[model samples]
Target: MNKREDISGFYERIHYLAPERIGADKPHINVFERASCIGAVPFSRRDYYKVTLILGTGRLDYANQSIYIDRPALVFSNPLIPYNWNPDSSDQHGWFCIFNQAFIQQREGLLNHLPMFQIDADKVFFPDADSVDEIAAFFKAMMRENTESYVHKDDILRNYLHLIIHHALKMQPARDYDRDLNAAARITNLFLALLNRQFPVDSRQHELQLRSAKDFAKQLSLHTNHLNRMVKEFTGKTTTEHIAARILLEAHDLLLHTDWPISEIGYRLGFQYPGYFNSFYKKHAGTTPNEVRKQAV
Candidate 1:
C-alpha cells in the first residue's frame, strides 16, 4: 500500500484555490466544489477523513465492495481504509471537504462515537432530493465561512461538521458488517486504534514505541498469545502481520515522499540497523528500500 496522501499533497494535486489556513502548518479543514475543480484524479487512498456529497452519477469502490450512484449520495471516508470514486459522466456536481483527525479531536469521544466514521460502518448514504439540497446547503455555508475572517470560524465549522454527521445518522444505517460487539471485538478495536494512533511518523524525533506484537500486547494489558488470538479472530490476520503491513506501508510512503536516507527511514521505523531494514523491506515489499526510492525517481 502507498503511503496515504497528506493534506498538502492532496491540495496540490487538486490545484486548490485560495486555501484558507487555520494555522501555520497544514490547515485543519478544506472545502471545494466538485464541478469547479479540475478532473478527478484516479482513485487512491487518502490519509485524512472526507465527507463528500455527489449530486450526479458515479461508481464508488470502497474496500472490497462496489456501489453505483445514480442519485445524490453522501460519502464518508476515513484514514483506516482505501476508497476511490469513478464518475460515470463528465458533468459531476457536488461538494467535498477534507479534514485531518486533529480537526475533529477537539470534542472528546466524538469521532469514535460517530457511526458513519467508524472503520467498519457503512460509509455511503443515498439521500432524497430534499436531503441533498439540505446537505449541499451546509457545504455551501462551510465554503462561505471558510473565507471569512471570524475568530470563531473553526468552532463554527466544527459545529457544521457535527450537524452533517447527525443528519446522516437520521437518514439510514450504513453498517453492514455483523460486528461481534463482544469483549474480543472491543479488544480488537482498541488494539487497532492503538496501532493506528502511532502512524504517519510525523517527525524523525518521533520514535515509534509499539513496534511488535509483544509491545502492543503490553500496552493493551493482555498476554501476547491472548492478544494475537483476539486480533487474529477478529481481523483474520495475525497480530504481527498487521504490524508489519502498517510499518511497510509507512516505509513505502516515506521512501517515495521524503528525502530521508535509507538508514534514517529504517531507524525511524524502529529497525536497529540499515541491513536489517533492507532485508525486512525486501521480505515484505519484494524490493529493498533503495530500489523503491530509485523506482519512484
Candidate 2:
C-alpha cells in the first residue's frame, strides 16, 4: 500500500498549529498558511480533498501530471490522485484548506462533478492579477472564520471554499463540457453514483452491498452486458473497471486508516478469505496488502 497522508499525519508532517483538533466526530474543515518546512510535500495519495492558493513559483507533481506554477494559482487536489508540491524557492507563501466528504453535509458528491477536481481538468489555474486580491480575500476570510466564535463557522468556511471554487471556475471559460447527457452517459453516471455509494469503507462489519458490475447493473435495472457496453462506450472504461478502481481506493483507505486485520478488511470488501483479498489487492494495486499495511506501521 502506498502511504496516504491522513489528516493527522499531514498536520504532523507539516507541523500544523492545531493538530489536536482531529477526531471522529470533530473532523471539520481546516485552514492553514504555508509552512516553512524544507523539501516537498510527500508524493503520495491523500485521504481528503485539498485546495491550495499557490502564491509563488512551485512545481506540483500530480501523479504523472507535472504542473509548474509561476504565478498566483489555485490548485485542486482530491484523494484519487497522488500529489506533491515542490516550491521553486524557500520564499513560499500561500494558503490552503483541507476538507473531505464529511464536511459537505448536503453535497456529499459535489466534488466529483466539479471541473477543477476532475482528473483530466486543468488542475492549475492562474487567476487574473486583478482577481488575485479577490481570491486571496476569500482565503483570508476563511482564516478569520476558522478561529471565530460564530455558531455557523463551518457554514462560513464552506461558503468561502465555494467562493474559491467559483472563482477558479470563472477563471476558466466554459469548455465543451456542458451538454445534455445521452442515455448511455446518463446510465454511466447513475452506475458511478451507485458504485460510489458503497465506498470509503470504514468498518469490518460494513461489507460492501454492491461488489461487481453485475450487481450494479441489476441494481440499475439494466442487463449486465448493456450496462457494461454503455459504461465502456461513454467512459472509456468497462463497468467492472470502474467498480474495481473504486473498491481498490476503498481498500487503500481502509488498510491505512484503520487497524482492522487484513482478513477482516478482506471480508468486508467481499473477499471471504485473506488469500483472495491479498491476490486481488496485488492484482489491482500492484502491491500486497501486507506491504501497504507496513507503511502505516
State which candidate has the highest lDDT. Answer: 1
Show how many residue pairs clash in every candidate, following the order shown: 1, 1
> Candidate 1: lDDT of 106?
56
Question: Per-residue lDDT of 1-297 in model 2, one digit per residue for the tens?
Answer: 345567887777776666356753454688877654445786666778889888878788753347888888888887766668888887778788898656754455555667676544677888888777988888888988888878788888888888899888887776544422478767877887687666556444578889888898889999999999998887688888787777776677667657888888889999988999999989998889898889779
Q: Tell me, what's the RMSD of every candidate?
A: 6.5, 6.2
| Cα lDDT listed for each candidate | 0.77, 0.76
TM-score of each: 0.63, 0.66
Regions of candidate 1 where Cα sits further than 4 Å from its true position: 1-3, 17-27, 173-189, 197-217, 222-297
* lDDT value, candidate 2, whole model: 0.76
